[model samples]
Target: MLSEVYPFQETAEAARRVQLNDHLGELGVLCLAPSPGLGVTDATLRSRIGEDRITSLMAA
Candidate 1:
């Protein structure tokens, strides 16, 4: 989830990083790498997933 909040060091990265990092620290974990194929190239799909948790809650 850290990758989702801080994908890069670019200025455009959202401020959610601090919150996410803190959350991970509370869980006794730190994200070391980004997931493969996690880049948001499809704006439509990304918007859908971001707007609702249903997509993430559903299982294959």
Candidate 2:
């Protein structure tokens, strides 16, 4: 189930890590965007369109 919502802090931490690595690129920093192996279907995303927050986030 996708009931477990990930908090914003986790996303912030990931961004912070990426920025840190990018800033220290002289140390041979490398980044790879591999598939997450899990994703919400288009139907599921469409279903969330009515939700104001979800819609706003999607728009952003």
Candidate 3:
């Protein structure tokens, strides 16, 4: 999903650096839910799209 909308054409680590930070970047529904009976853990979080980006995309 994040692959198409944002074109990371200038880096060697394009796949690793690409993010859904554009308005249409993550063009699908996504939900975050906790796993049942799973209490543990640490996670690395990344920001997909910022509020400004969404607003800009919508206005376009």
Candidate 4:
């Protein structure tokens, strides 16, 4: 369920980790979640789109 909402990409692991961490960080701060738990983890969100395109999304 969480993975469906935040899928992952097949990009380099480093790049994926950085982008995912940033995205989850932003979402965590926005939602004020204690932490990026099962609701927001690499495995949980390793299939969603637009996660790598966070620069554009954040600017907007």
Worst 10 residues of 1 by lDDT: 24-33
What pairs collide in candidate 3?
A: none
lDDT at 51, model 3 = 33
Backbone N/Cα/C clashes per model: 0, 0, 0, 7
**Cα lDDT tens digits for candidate 1, 14-49:** 444455553342111113325333345577877877
Candidates in order have lDDT scores of 0.38, 0.36, 0.29, 0.35
RMSD of 3: 12.7
- Number of the predicted model whose TM-score against the real structure is largest: 2
Instruction: For residue 29, give model 2's deviation from the true position in Å.
Output: 19
Model 2, range 1-60, lDDT digits (tens) per residue? Answer: 211222343555545656776433222111221223233446776577644434211100
TM per candidate comes to: 0.21, 0.26, 0.14, 0.20
Model 3, residue 37: what's the lDDT? 25
Q: Which of candidates 3 and 4 is the stronger one according to lDDT?
A: 4
- On lDDT, the candidate that comes out on top is 1
Location of the lowest summed lDDT over 10 successive residues in candidate 2: 25-34
Q: Please give the distance, in angstroms, between residue 30's alpha carbon in candidate 3 and its true position after superposition.
A: 18
